[model samples]
Target: MTRVAVIARILPVLAILVWSLQGVSRAENALTLDLSDYELTFEEDFDRLDVSAWGPGTRWIAHTPWNGDFGDAAFADPRPGFPFTVKDGVLAIEARKDEGGKWASGLLASVDGAGRGFSQRYGYFEMRAKFPKGEGTWPAFWLIGLDRLTHTSEVDVVEHYGHFPGRYTASVHVWDRKTASKSSSVHHRVLVAPGSLYDDYNTFGAKIDADWIIFYFNRQEVWRQSTPEHHKQPMYLLVDLGVGAGWPTENTPDPSVMLVDYVKVWARED
Candidate 1:
C-alpha cells in the first residue's frame, strides 16, 4: 500500500477514537461528584416505605418512639395511618389538626426511643424531598447523635420553614462535654426562589468527614465548613414536618404535607 493510502485509512479511525473520548469526558464533568469514590451504606426510596437493603427493618425504625415533642408544633406518634403514609412510591408526612383543632405533625427518627438503630460516624448523606408550603410550617431532613439530641450534635441538611417559602437552612452544631451548656455551630440560610421548594423535588446532601462538613442542594455544593471537634460520634437520621421551631403554629394551615422520594448515604471508598 502507498504511504498516502495508509495515512488516509488511519485518519478516520483516529478521529472516531478522539470523538468517543470527548463524549466520556463530558459525562464525567457533568456529574456533581464521582460516585465511584464511595460505597453505598444506606438508602431509602420509600417505595414501600420499608423494603430496601439498608432499610425495611435494618436501617430506619419508622417511628420516633419518644415521649414529648419539641419546636413550635406538636409532634404526633409516627404511626401507620394518620400522619404517615406510603402512596405512589412516596412517603408523605402530613401536618393537620384533629377534631379539637389541636395541631399535629409527623416525626421519624432512625433510632428508637431507647436510642438503638443505625448510626454512622462519617459519610455522605442525601435526600430528595418536596417541602410543604404554608405559614408556620417547618419541614426538615436532619440528623442527630444516635444517643439523641441531648448531646446536641445535630446536622441540619435541609430545613424549610413554610413562612419563608424557598429558603432552607443548613447547619451543624456540637454541644458536648466541652460546650459547658453552650454550643458551637455553623449555619447557612440558603435561598433559591420564592416558593421554589414547593414547586418540585430538590436533592439536599451533606458530606461529613473528619475535617469538614460540606452541604449541597440539587447535587451542587452550596456551603461548607471545618468539622467541629465535638462532633466525634455516630449520628442517626430524622425527618419531620413541624409547626414551628420556636414560633407559634396558630397561623399554620390544617393540611400540609411533605413528600419524600428517597434518602441515601455512602461511605468513602478509602
Candidate 2:
C-alpha cells in the first residue's frame, strides 16, 4: 500500500459541519452535512510533493495516466522547485517561462500510467487553494473517471482562467469512444468579484452520489447536475497550473504560482 493509504488507515476520523441546503435555491434554507457519517479516505497536505513520474508507492504522478497533457504550457516532470514546490504546508504549482522562453508548468494526478493509486466511486472531494492572476493563467482541480478502456468521464470541480477574473467554470462531460464525440456535457459559471480569488484562499468541493453531482464553493452549494451514466465508475484527482486554455499567454506573469493548502476526500458510511 502507498504511504498515504497507510496514513489514512491510522488517522482518527473527525466530524465536520459543512453546509445544509433545503432546496435547489441556495438562499432559501441552509442545511449541514453531517460529516460524522463519512470516513476520511484520502488527504494530501503537501508537507512535501510525494510525487513521481510513475509510481509504486508515491501518492501522485507528474503526468496524466493517458499522456493527454493540455493547455499552452507543458506539464513538465517534477524537479527541484521549478514547476512544483512545498513550503509551510502548502503546494505551489508554478507556471513560468524558462531561460529559453518556453512555458512549462506542473500537474499532479492521484493515479499513474498503470492506473495504480487512489480512486473512489462516490465521495466528497475538496481542495483549498488560491489562484494566480494574469491574462493567461489557467488553474484547475478536476477528476477523471478510471474506465478509460471504453469511454471517458470527467468532472471539473473548478477551472479558473485568469483572463476572466470575475468568474470560474465547472463542467461534467462524457465522451463516447465509438463515435469519437462528447455525447454529454454541461458547464456552469460561478461568479465572484474580480481579483477576489487571487486575494485569498477558497475551498472548492464536489459531492458525488449515485444520482447527483453537487458542487460547492467555500462549503456552499453553487451548482449541480444529474450523475452521468458514464460517471458511475471510479474517479481520480488532478490539479495543475496550466497556461492558456485558449487564452493568450503573452501577458501571463513570468512566474505565476497557484497555492494549494490541502486536498482531501471522504467516503460515505453505509
- Highest TM-score against the true fold, candidate: 2
The estimated TM-scores of all candidates read 0.79, 0.87
List the candidate 2 regions with Cα displacement exceeding 4 Å: 1-34
- Mind giving the per-residue lDDT tens digits that candidate 1 earns over 1-270? 001122234333211111111111111122365567899998788877541212335445544544445554566645567577888878998988888887787777776666666678888888899988788887888877655345557788887767777577787765443333354445577767787799999888888889988778787777776776656678788887877665467777788899999888898888
Task: For model 1, name the residue pairs that clash.
Answer: 50-56
Candidate 2 structure, TM-score to reference? 0.87
lDDT for model 1, please: 0.68
Q: Considering summed lDDT, which 10 consecutive residues are worst modelled in model 1?
A: 18-27
Instruction: Kindly report the root-mean-square deviation of model 1 from the true structure over all alpha carbons.
Output: 18.6
